[model samples]
Target: MNGKFIAIEGLEGAGKTNAIKQVGKILQEQGVHKIVFTREPGGTPLAEALRTLVKYGIDDEVITHEAELLMLYAARVQVLENVIKPAVTQGAWVVTDRYDLSSQAYQGGGRGIDSGLLNTLRDTILGNFYPDLTLYMDVAPSIGLKRVRSRTSGELDRIEVEPLAFFERIRSRYQILAEKDDRIITLDASQELSEVTSALRVQLIKWLKNKGY
Candidate 1:
């Protein structure tokens, strides 16, 4: 059987990292072996290098929106071929930090890139690789920005440096995607961190049970 792929997605400061960690622990306690946790844009060496360049090197004016979108897929294709597909074929459950939705939200929605182009790239490059389940941690842009500013001590990433309006558009696009996709579970991320984790845990347990885990 193919391994189940679960993806966690949200804006910065939406507690995606913490939630994934907690979910891993919970899965461990449940005696689920072959659980693999990874993140996009950096799951492999090549992807990691691309991630750093995309996040930090804003001076590369050649990295236009189109270039950015293709680069993301390039990394994704590598991850899918080298890590994700192999593990899943080996019956390992995979938890990813982000996936194609980030590309859709950031490049297509936030940057005003054409949705048609994004969809075309996804179809051509990614094909039918869809998450079994996606946990979308939802929060207001203002609150999310405040949390991010308070947590990060270093320079902001290219996406983080975007204007508030950009973030708002991104968040709105996330909401729309979650609403349209039944596989996506939207969670309120504006609540206390502990509370948010608890809710996520509950939802996860329910999903696992339903999946006959």
Candidate 2:
């Protein structure tokens, strides 16, 4: 694809929605007006259905770990094929809230699934496709959950109600992945909103310039 693809990744309550806004603002200021905003598991109609099933299964219908993992990728490829690939192919920047990294953290780390198997599934579905840049918003689970509680008024989705240990593992995996990938940068989401935005803006501007955008 000719256009850049940037993925914003983090655990729940990491302010990814706001981060996407900052990304849009940064690109707009750089004279890049054609941009598409998307999130994993819900960017298209079918994907949205999968998203609902993943987040909230119908009345006690158990969502097994295997099913959750598969559904996530299923929705992901749908969005990638119908939305992300086309947007980037048409020279429009794509800004996504989450992608494969999430599955790695949530399923592989948090749920104790093996990374090797997840890798196989990822390769089978996505092949060599990946975002050019991924910004991981790092925050302590306790602090993040507090923010989440305030925002959601203590109401949480199924996954959001997972134990604190789940998020800890997810964050640990995120840190490891960020350390290994040059294209992924870890941002401290615990900072004030303005500071977080400034840091994100600077990182994106530098990366975009490096890419000759």
Q: Over the stretch 1-213, how does candidate 1's per-residue lDDT look in tens digits?
A: 777899999998899999899888888877777898888887999998888877876575656777777788888998888899899999998999999999999887898898998999999998999999999999998999999999899988887888999999999999998999989999999999989989999999999899888
Pull out the clashing pairs in model 2. none
TM-score of 2: 0.97
Give the top-scoring candidate (TM-score).
2
| CA lDDT scores, all candidates in order | 0.89, 0.92
TM-score of 1: 0.96
Model 1: lDDT of residue 59: 72
Alpha carbon lDDT of residue 73, candidate 1? 88
Candidate 1 ranges beyond 4 A from true positions: 58-62
Poorly placed runs, candidate 2 (over 4 Å): none
Model 2 lDDT tens row, 79-99: 999999999999999999899
Residue 26 error for model 2, in Å?
Answer: 0.5
